[model samples]
Target chain A: MTKESKKDGGVNPRDEAKERLENFALKVLESVNQIEPPKISIPSRSTSNIVFDEKERYYTISGKTVTRTSANMRQVKKFAQTMCAADFCKDLIESKKTATLREMYYISEGWETGGFADQGRSDRIVEDLESTFGVKREDLGLLPEEDGASIFGDIVIDEGGMEVKATKVGRAGYTIPPTMSDVEFVECGADCVLAVETMGMYHRLIQEEAWKKFDALVVALKGQPARATRRFLKRANKELDLPVYLFTDGDPFGFHIAMVVISGSAQLAYINHELAVPEAQFIGVTASDIENYDLPTDKLRESDVQRLKQLLKDPRYSDDIWQSEIKKMLNLNKKAEQQAFSKYGLEYVVDKYLPEKLT
Target chain B: MTKESKKDGGVNPRDEAKERLENFALKVLESVNQIEPPKISIPSRSTSNIVFDEKERYYTISGKTVTRTSANMRQVKKFAQTMCAADFCKDLIESKKTATLREMYYISEGWETGGFADQGRSDRIVEDLESTFGVKREDLGLLPEEDGASIFGDIVIDEGGMEVKATKVGRAGYTIPPTMSDVEFVECGADCVLAVETMGMYHRLIQEEAWKKFDALVVALKGQPARATRRFLKRANKELDLPVYLFTDGDPFGFHIAMVVISGSAQLAYINHELAVPEAQFIGVTASDIENYDLPTDKLRESDVQRLKQLLKDPRYSDDIWQSEIKKMLNLNKKAEQQAFSKYGLEYVVDKYLPEKLT
Candidate 1:
């Protein structure tokens, strides 16, 4: 929808989330006191409700809603969980803290009757809360536990209050945090952001100082871009005026990861406006690269072939570039990793392939 | 077993590795040219060859050897692969570059008959080379593709020639590189290092600035410690004289990971001296923690119980503390995660649990 704000004409996302949760809890409390049904309405997050917002260049939810009420036994446990989770988020914001999704699941164990039996059930509630409140889970001080991705090169960021230069960090670069809300881009000397899908390729690029050659900041997505990684790239792409290029393997899964980073995943469509980098480009290890670079490749597995066929119908991959690439990959019956470029030599990807693709 | 060195009264691990490879290659060439069978003798790395080196406080190989020769059809491929891998490594060293194990495996795809059918075959060759040459794969310019692990707190490391202050970095801290040989400990402000098993707990500690509270450098192990993470911990412990305490989930798998950091795993027994930190201690989320903190727990799965049974017989976990802990967990039939402490509050792990355990 729109950026969160406060009554005093200032933007405070955390405060906004806290206030939303408080207001929601108040409504339920008042309903209970009046001997009326306590219920929460959340947007339907089913696949049928997902739509490719061509104007926004990302997946988003349609205007369909589902209501959960304490009145129905089948929906009561979920209803109670939703209320309890809202309370938990409020407590986190009040304490100026956050909880990982996994931690939140475990923390629920202490709740009298609102505890979650599994993480998947707890995760769905967080998603429901996000859509119900029109805010990100990140805004609600609920973070998903993410893999350690990394960023390197000529960029400065204000973490909490301290300014840190990515260039001045460790050899492996700066660790991409679980949340990027507290991080503000202070400065950038890069022309673009190169997001590599594999850590091996990313490390090779860093070791070869490819960032300097391209005058770009490099980030390792570490497979499918983690939410924090996508947000980091989005901010870097937007705030720093840097174009984003996603470099991944020559497979359906890799192409899908690039699509997720560029246009947002259907599953997480609710946060597309905040997380998606619609301008992001997918640069190589595409099916064409296998032929052009004569890269080493593995025969596509049965699952890979199936994924490619499915992606052919996915709206996110409808663009000519993606469609052509996916079709070519299926035809070739081959998949190559980012590391497959090393068949040319260890420096080939950094010294040759990347320069060719980016330039 | 002594430090790698150049003949010119200087220590240069890379150069030393290069020389060893060159010499080995020369011997092989001589054998082939003279029409003799080209053979390489490698230290046996099987379980029977592993021993608990009590003085070293780690697992190491015993005085046993195995031979691979081009004389046999089965060994011929391995023999050729070894020769080609050495040549590949020499090229990397000469070019002042490195290949990730995955890349090396892929690179071999161009080596005609020397190409590996799978990554497993290639990985074993690298390990064989390591034990054969008495040098780490890192020294040979063969790097393992590792998960991104972070290091935070008051410590300075010389990455290549540039110095990095981990505390002055981003919110997630310094990203620990795949190889730590090039990283020199420059300075330290912390008294000890806290190696965390999970990123979620690590993030919680960072959010709360637990390092400041305990005067410790906090490192996220990101599950069963990657080789790079273990090396980073070892170097930090040994070079900075910082005591290391591993904080992990109170489960059989978690305990085993902690043990791997303290006493090297049997599989990589060859690199124990370089990678293992014998003095490292498990700081809890122990079986004791389940009772001590009234932490939330899950019933030990059949798998967890089996793993505990295995660890009970593992030499690394033979001590009274481990034996007692493993038995207690079995008796309780329960396991807990580092995040289980979040049942109290998001900051419980950092503000309370760690401070209590670390102190």
Candidate 2:
């Protein structure tokens, strides 16, 4: 859903979009116009190429390789395809039109003719371009659409002449853009952010005026947070320097979603720094919280047991909080979704759970 | 395996192949020359468009609608591509070359430009052309080479000056072409055809001189009978009027293979008359044969159990023999492979099992 822009006075992005495209093209032309063989540098997304920095509390791509003409002809196809996609993506941004990953694939197919076998090759090339530029595809105005997140907060943002007040939208809320670098956050009043896993729980809190009462912004992740939701939450945590907390189902998927938000997803491992909210904490529906709140038991699904068993083996969940909480869940053989808190009464979540957890 | 010529006197097929190619191209040119909208008829392989005839004992394409330039523009593209493929196959035949289904798909993709989505669409169109022409792709000289079935019989045929006598090839046998319309079987001395499911049993019987002793022709199916095996067996049954017996393990896959040979596979359902051996008898290693032969029991694998359970529910397995045999297998939770017959003695299958079962 589109929201009214909060900053009608913000700078127009059309000129900025053109400038970004021109700069990307200039880099390519500069390399091509070189006296020596062109060497393009790119960060490797392969796990072997990523390093965990405990001091910085985040992971970063370590292997920065410069592509040059060598005896190994293996990189020839990849290098040509990456350069082709980069040139194409710049054209997309300059034309002021967004292309889905699928559209970009078809465009590549048309450009390369018989060179491309299928969409998979094109998708990899797009990723190579993203890693090379140190930016997300959405930042280049390419989008898949319909999977961005919903946010209701005391924040103001403008797109073109449209002014959107996130807090005033009430229960409906505003959709976070797939790429928020273009969106200007004119004002920020929320003290913290509560990222809820389910829309049902988010609405209940909204109906109760939980955000206004607790002075926190509420985000409904819908299930596992989409790439846009994670990006938005990461930015909110960093820019406002506000504490971010996650509330999800007391199930394995929920635990993994929370982990993915805090520590980046492996699929998008290359751009982890642009998305992860490392300092974020999960607030509810943790395993122990079920007994403390006397939430009614829902029978554990077969999938829940399987996922819980898996989480126990994962190295990342070796932390004391994750291990103990997961162990408790396994022993209970029951998972409580966030909506289960409604068993304590609709207002109980905002009145009791929030006060107890937050304080 | 190459065999000596049983007959040096046979028709040369280069002229025949050339004639077929000229006729195909002329038909396309005639369509182009037509003053009005030209029409093309194809036997649609869609299950919904198929009609099962119990009386005639075969399935036929129901719709007789010729593809023209009216509303259903769907057939126009398919018709053009199919004609294009037929033209390409003729080119392969005339050029004395062969192409696999994958090669054929790439040829279609190159020829039609944007007509195909994948190999699957191209394959279906090829099948349509095959059904329409009443010929196999290999018969049109588009050979995949390795998937063809091998047969050992007192028969001979000549192709492009190469003469092959099935009996002279000895134990190695002659690989049957996908289609036998051009092949000439010069001799048939055997009383019947023994279609053994495994090469082990076929070899054992051949070594024992069982074919000459019992006045029978032996065919080792290797595993599930390929299209070539099914077609050759069907033609032998129809033309030579030879009694055909199928010998397979008392298991689910074995049963399915027997059924495919008896009532053609759904994949080739359009060409049932050219492949199915409905009158063929199932011989040996049945559920009841365990006690008669004192075969040792082997526990059924999980996949075997699943397949057995599925076979019981199939509408076609409603026959009394199939029901009783499968029911017994499910109840026992055991299966006996055909090799189990060797438990009595090395030649027990030929000496005892065959004598008892055939009698």
Candidate 3:
């Protein structure tokens, strides 16, 4: 046989064995697919504990019970593993690169929590994704929270609505996903569901069950939203029946967030018309309130004023009354916080928004 | 043999040798000190042909120049090295503290030209100084030219007469001490001598050759008696016959300089009250100039203002018109530099002071 077919004991022996094993595994996979596939018995929850109820099917994957008809525990594990492996696999396929099989296996398992268990590792992975695939934390709904909970699942609110926040936690956790049950729940019907967001407000919202239920959801977008957040908000309004009201501090970051939500082009993303939500209104902690409330001048930072003035140059936001109010705040060099409204106590908010109060 | 006297070649030989060297060095230093006796030599112009003559008087210790006169530079360098031993030294010291040992040395050498050489090294030294000492650059002043040239000489100009600046540079080639000549010339009844000041100003004036052709000689007295800058003015009035006038800046430094000339202080070796001169009047750049000329705000730093105000509160200086005027300048944050009267190039100053023909 030619050198290709020869399996002599030399430097090429190990390489030949590895190729043989890979080809054998591929053949086995093909045969496994072809052979009458084993019927995966998905566990079903019956109305009565007796006869089989074929109509409503249930299954468990890595201990989580899911109701989706096509779900199988083994299949989900496989899918999770596949998704995890996809990071490396895609990298390999696109770049003609390859990593150890063990690395691929661990990466697949890592996708169960979207790799957030080890924060440092998750952040690194997200960064790699962003740099390599142009994927944003907001796009993956993996953005950070300002306060409370290590992940979106841990964010629990009582009767008082949830506060979603994002700082510089991770790239994945900044933008909120619209597909989250909470976002859908808020979007569906709940009135006065305030989304007290910090930096990563949108990213966390899209992962919750309450996002769909709100009649009027207050979105406190901190700095600005990425393209994904804007896109989600646009899709959310179009597909769901909720109106988004934005509230931010009377500073550059706050002003920019409102502008992003309403008109949609911020520093990085240029999805202006595609992502802009025309109905979203700027609300609360206005520049006019700073003087009217007799706020302390020292509370205002000159850098903050300088930043706000920079945003006023953007034509998309320049004409906005809120932008003008922000400019006035800068000129006066005074700042007032949202809690400052409580200086007048609950009475002030009631008096100001009494007629329009949902409750 | 005793340990002190033994020349041991044993285990401790190195220590013994070191001890011997130390003792020898100490003895040599002591002998050198006895021989030199720490004499303060006033350098003659011919000391060094290549190097400039003026800087020769700066004190040296063991052949090394006393690089700094104040604790400021020492402190700054110490702090900078302690904080962060990075390249920050250059930026911190240079921009923060403009003058360094080399620049000071150059200044002492009569290189009166502005701008610093070896800016990088100077900057590093200043940064090191600031970092170590916490002294800001603005607090220091270069030694005045006249003071540096004279071996401690003083000059005084009387009110309502021609302005005369007596400096050593004017007597560059003169050999006989001006002090003796002035005493002899005044006693002989010179016709053109305008004033007969105390030994101090008279010495400097004669050195400058200004005493040769003046009008009357006014001899200033301490407490209205026989002597000072005022004695010279009175003598000039009697012998050479000329009207007298005075000029000074708008600050405490200038005020005190004038006072020293008119009233002989005990510290100046003119202790007799008989030598006090009471007739001299104050001239322009008074405290009122602060309000009269709408000067820069906060010219007198807040601390300085507070100190001056405290001084004004004192019973001694409070009611004094001159002191109160100084306080007014501090309050209004206005200052008058002699340069402001001319070099500031204000059209009002030119039109008001200079003749129309010159304009």
Candidate 4:
């Protein structure tokens, strides 16, 4: 057969298809920018050597040419300062907390990793709290009780209340003891004991426990409780029938620990069923307090609401009252902690925890 | 400190780290070919074109690649022929039987998804067997007497007794009626019948009601019968002296099935102690058969032996006889089956099952 006759049709299908494809390619190519010739310039100093063609609106010149000068040093410095200020403001706004003097100092030093200075400064702050405020290192309860004391001291309050204190920043403000170990719970002479936390608050509680001589004793777990601490609390509750009043920093993890005491998680295996007391209540630095006391809005981080919501979703948290309260806090998008007590000092907690009549 | 002195000791750590990384990259590029590439090839040619240079010399390709060429076409045809030959030789080699020309043709083409050409070819073969050899399909009890004429006329028997009779291509094979299911047993005309299967095999017997033929029938089930199948089998076994003959696939599953059949798996739901039969014997296709039969070297797949050994390791399968037999099979790496009858054909089976005196 002839090649043309062998074709499927009279039309040249391949050629027709190629033409259609070329048209589509042309349309796509039209979307891209067209190239242009670079602009040429001549300096006024080379005017004698240059020939200006008015008709063509073109000028020919010698080697010398004029160009815009680069940004001045003052402008550069101003730009940098503006950028730094913008970043600082952004971080402050994002965190909702003012950049501390120490943080600003670290940033100015160009230590992007914040270096050892940040950690050392934090340690110095903790040391100040210990020596200046007469906060016992043992009462700080930094290390895991099981490991004994590493950096921070173990604070065992009367009535099986325990806390870990640490100078270094890590997982918890203080290291928690392993779940397997037993915690020391001292007897502080009370039917019901209030475990006041934080250095200043603990000092006040000790003075109150001595002076008031009330039927209820006040023990201060100055730092976060180690795992053994919870077990000790459980033993105290079971043996002494002393109701546990947990107080901690007003933060997500702090709230979680209080809930852990009330509704034990799988982590606290030994005391899971035994240590958990359903009646434990969050006594201070609540959302209501944040609103009523007009605490610093900066203390409320953006993640606070989300973290509270997650804590509410936990199956272990069975108390509807606590759930509803936490939900309210999340709704308000705010959080408060008794550590704000540091701003007010020891006097504020005494007035808050122990009323004038009780004292 | 002088700026130069400070600069002398202080090198930018990040810059030094980056330099080291660049050096490492250069070294890696130098030895690019020395690094092994993944064995698998990418599926898409377009993507592979961007990532790999086909012209570059690299390690030898491990897998075969097919191309559309006349030589490839010849290889393809040869492969199909080899597979066909393997199928044809399977039974003959296994049973030491000579394949007839017709049997060879049937073996090669009969079991294909589609019906063989000349639809009545199998029927004609059966007719030749009866008319020319004086061996009737009914005499052999290959088909139920009710459907003897139709089945004998239509069924196609390959060198292996696996009969294939299809009305059309790509259709399911015709179901054999229970009466015609086991020709050898039906043709025996014996008083007592022993029907054994690897553990789970009894379900088919019970479903088929093939156990009702003899005065005292044994329905053997391999593997431990689950509660329900076991209960039903036992109820059926109890109704008549229908003793079960449990033949297993000579693997762990087989042994487990027997154990479950004989001693109910208490852990499983629905097991009944009374349903378990104590008299089941481990027979046929034992690991020992590999040695006894002198099977072709490496006939047993490695995976098969591994699985069998694992089954033998099960405490339930640790009986001295069972263990010894399994070890023998492991050493020889072979297995046997009742389906071996299919390979031996009518004469060999007749000699084996029915001697001259019995005939």
Q: After superposition, how far is residue B243 of candidate 1 from its true place, in Å?
A: 2.1
How would the candidate models be sorted by lDDT, starting from the highest?
A: 1, 2, 4, 3
Q: Candidate 1 docking: what grade?
A: medium
Q: Against the true structure, whose lDDT is highest?
A: 1
Candidate 3: CAPRI quality band:
incorrect
Off by over 4 Å in 1: A1-10, A25-38, A70-80, A112-114, B1-10, B26-38, B69-77, B110-114, B355-359
TM-score of 2: 0.46
Global lDDT of each candidate: 0.82, 0.66, 0.35, 0.37
Candidate 2: tens digits of C-alpha lDDT, residues B130-227: 67766666566554423345566665655433456555532334555444435555567777888887655655566566787777778877688767
If ranked by TM-score, best first, what sequence of candidates would result?
1, 2, 3, 4
Q: Per-residue alpha-carbon lDDT of model 3 for A1-359, expressed as tens digits?
A: 00111111223322332343344345435646877332222122232222211221111112122222114654554333333433343434343222222223223332443422333554444433332233333333233322111112222111113333221112112223221212322212333324333422222232232234332333434345544355545644555434556655556666666666665443223113445666765664666767666532235677885677676765555456856786787677776544333233223433443223222
* Residue-wise C-alpha lDDT for candidate 4, range B92-200, written one tens digit per residue: 3333222223223333343443223432544333333222222223222222111100111111222113323211101111222212211111111113323344211
DockQ in order: 0.67, 0.01, 0.01, 0.00
Model 4 misplaced regions, further than 4 Å: A1-188, A207-217, A220-224, A297-299, A342-345, A353-359, B1-359
Per-residue alpha-carbon lDDT of model 4 for A1-359, expressed as tens digits? Answer: 00111111233322333343344335334533343221212133333544432332223233455321114543433323323333343333343222222233333333232222333544333233222222222223211212211111122222123222221111111222222122333323345545544433443343333224434434444355544455546554665566666666556777776766666554332214434555555564566666665654334576876787777876554458667767767777766556344234224455654442233
Q: For all the candidates, what are their Cα RMSDs to the real structure? A: 4.3, 29.2, 37.3, 43.0
iRMS of each prediction: 1.7, 34.6, 39.4, 44.2
Highest TM-score: which candidate?
1
What DockQ does candidate 2 score?
0.01
Model 1, span B206-283: residue lDDT tens: 878888888888898988888878877876676566799988888877888888999988888877888899999888
How does residue B122 of candidate 3 score in lDDT? 41
Better of 2 and 4 by TM-score: 2
